[model samples]
Target: MKECVLLVFLALCSAKPLFRPSYMTLKNMMLKDMEDEGDGDGDVDNSLFPTREPINSFFPFDLSPTCPFGCQCYSRVVHCSDLGLSSVPSNIPLDTRMVDLQNNKIKEIKENDFKGLTSLYALILNNNKLTKIHPKAFQTTKKLRRLYLSHNQLNEIPLNLPKSLAELRIHDNKVKKIQKETFKGMNALHVLEMSANPLDNNGIEPGAFEGLTVFHVRIAEAKLTSIPKELPSTLLELHLDYNKISNVELEDFKRYKDLQRLGLGNNRITDIENGSLANIPRIREIHLEHNKLKKIPSGLQELKYLQIIFLHSNSITKVGVNDFCPTVPKMKKSLYSAISLFQNPMKYWEIQPATFRCVLSRLSVQLGNFRK
Candidate 1:
């Protein structure tokens, strides 16, 4: 009987462990981990979030159309323009700096469309179906600088533009022609690009830009047969690319003393005389790519300040002595002068027939000129 009592005592001692406080506490903690309570960390990682926040939302300004669904909202300036919107957003935030509404289906702009935007600087409405601009389209804001309306169905330039406007790009529109007084009063205008319009066929009369003060004018790729003689004297950069100009005289550019760059690429120019560019002394860069030419012009050697010259894809077969090295005689004065003859087949031999002639000609030059 005593032995039986001792066995019962031993059994009770072993079972006591199951009900102990430490063992129960450990078992409960293990069950919590097994139940997947986020690895016991306080923060939850959200890698599955669908969309990210906007960049302009942190700006101090109040710009906006708030963003559309699946987009984040921003403040400095909203870009809800390319959404094919028919009209401007109503609840756009104030103090906007710039608004881009390009490539949309917007048809009209009411007077109050941009009512509260006091700090708006640039407004881009290119490639839209805007047929009309309200008279007070930009009555409120005076700080607006640039306005772009290219490739639109507008019949005329906006008369609501501010005089303080510096740059205006309204090319490729339904406008027929620019009258002498169309942009005559814009004293601050500097750059104007009005190419690819069909207005020249109707007759671009003289003094079209009568009193305009633009410096850079681009009227290339408009199927022009003759250069516009009414160009401003202050015109600095002229791009007449892809035109039908086969006859370019010397005096055509004589009036533009301040002309810096001239782009006549992709034209049907077959001939260039010796003094073709003597008038424009300030010509620095000339791009005559894809033109018909047999040899380099003579007076190009006189352009003392010419820096870069591009003559790619021409019909020149051979290059003799002083073809490029002596073309610009004053190239030695400048530190750097780059001439690109890419896309041309130049067969320069290691030991050419005229190699000795070039060396002898250099030695025969006037000794006084070399010393001076």
Candidate 2:
């Protein structure tokens, strides 16, 4: 038994190669094992571990006006109207700036409706059957300016508006109220046309105009009872016509020192406060037509540049000619100076029309010659 044990120990020591771990052998064995596992699973889960794949960045497809039938295709006019499209095109080129998908049968706007068009500026989805604009549906277009969502079935305004908006026309929809912060971060918003839709005044917050930096802004038919804060400081024109704005505080027009024209036509404004037009130094024209004013505010002496004051169809019964004499010479100096008191019961002054025409003709010639 001792001899047999000695022979077995010698056999083990003298084996072909002692069982030892080698760095190269272990690496090769590991690679073989990985290959065997990959082959066993048919490489289905190989992507579970990360591996680099070549990315082709250039767009390979051609945009050769292959829009649907009855659609006009010019440079960027994708007039898919009346073609029965279900949604907007998702695979448009990144450089697409204009899209006119109006008058279509689109009912829903999913997330993939507008996927990659980054340079799109004008999105005209008017006259469509859009019931809902999905949240973040307008995410990729960083340069969207003018959006026409009129004549749709949208009950509320979509959130996350693009920043580059300049003109928005969403009229003739089912929007009930102007949501608070609806105009947030819209710095360059200039024209907002929300007419024909009912807007509740209580939903409009005080700082709604905080992000806009407009010079002349108009909400032609918005239901506003009072002016909000941070109105454009350099407001050259304001059109608040066809609304229920009745109150005009002294501080409303005080900050608009350089206002050139104001339109309060077709509103419920009854009384203008004292010194309301005092601080507006450059106000040249005003439209007070179709208001509820029983008496004119007592501060015409402060308007040094008053031109055309339209008081047509108001409830004033009498006139004060003394308010006219002071503002005449200033109008005579300016080319854009005139007063429209038609449809009002105010007594007319004896200013000669021929003299006014002669002055305007001479000024027109001089202005035209100066422009040349």
Candidate 3:
């Protein structure tokens, strides 16, 4: 009986309780098993748990019917002018025809920013803070016609411009030079305005405007001391005012026979060759205000179609008979021809009474109104 009790006590003491794992331990073991199964080199068995779909499998929500906040939209035309915006609006409709985003704070134009807008014709981004543009920014917008990028901070002309562009205005920027390929494909470009830049004569490449048939070219305040050679023959209006041009040679206006209006005001022109205006037959208006002319140019009398001549703030001391007598016949036919000689030294000089009467009467006979 003693031996049986001893054996029962030893058995009871050596026996172990049932091994039951906690809920947290069981969850950890199951996760480890799943991770090991996933890392296996063989194909995964999807019978236990189904696989989930990717996050980007669905299409984005539709936000194209309405314009961006603080913008006005009317029949596919969006106007976001002066909105204090810092970047291009993200919610602009892809089918927009015209987008006016002037007077904004936009800095850069990234690639594909204007994608999928095939009908976009006009884009106005003037008076903005644009600094850079991606190379493929306008690759999708091939139908763009008019682009206004004036009054910005662009350092050079953007490349890969659309060939369908007709009018491009990029005035008042920091463009230092125009490369030969800047407007390579721009065959339809008619009007180009690049005023108020630091462009010199060397900045333009030879045959820069070769393939182009631009009609109007304005490069005022560009620090040009001489006339740019090889100008477009189809030019009708040329504005080079507020420059450093000191003289007009005989062949300066030789190629510009179709030029109607020529602006050379506020320049340092002290002398003009007698035959400078001989080539321009259809010249109507000439602006020579605030120049250093000591006497009137002799070629002025030959311009038969001359209507208006601005010679104010010059150094003219007297009027001669030959100046007004030669052009009396031509001026008598035109009813709108006038010569402005205000704020000159002639106003303070003592003119001979006989000479003044002869010149004044002759001018009065030609022009309807004569004022000295």
TM-score of 2: 0.68
- Position 212, candidate 3: lDDT: 82
Q: Candidate 2 lDDT, tens digit per residue, 1-372?
A: 999999999999888975998755755665576555553423332121124211111223223445545555444445566677776765454545577788888888887677776656788889988888888888887668788888888887787878778878887777766555777888877767666666646655566666566666565676677764456575777777788889678888876888888888898888888878787778877888788776655666456576666666766655454443345554443443545445555443442344234223433211111010
lDDT of 2 at 219: 56
Model 1, global lDDT: 0.65
Instruction: State every prediction's TM-score relative to the real structure.
Output: 0.67, 0.68, 0.74
Task: Please identify model 3 stretches exceeding 4 Å from their true place.
Answer: 1-64, 324-333, 347-372
Encode model 3's per-residue lDDT on 1-372: one tens digit a residue.
Answer: 999999999999999988899855755666576666563445432221224321212323322356888898765578899998888888788857788999999999989778887667889999999999898988988878888999999999899999888888999999988888888868888888999989988888887777787888999989889878766777888899999999999888888889888899999999898888887878878888888888877766556566677777777666665453343643542332456666666643344343222232335322122234
Clashes by residue pair, model 2:
308-338
How many steric overlaps are in each model, in order?
A: 1, 1, 0
lDDT of 2 at 155: 82
lDDT of model 1 at residue 127? 87
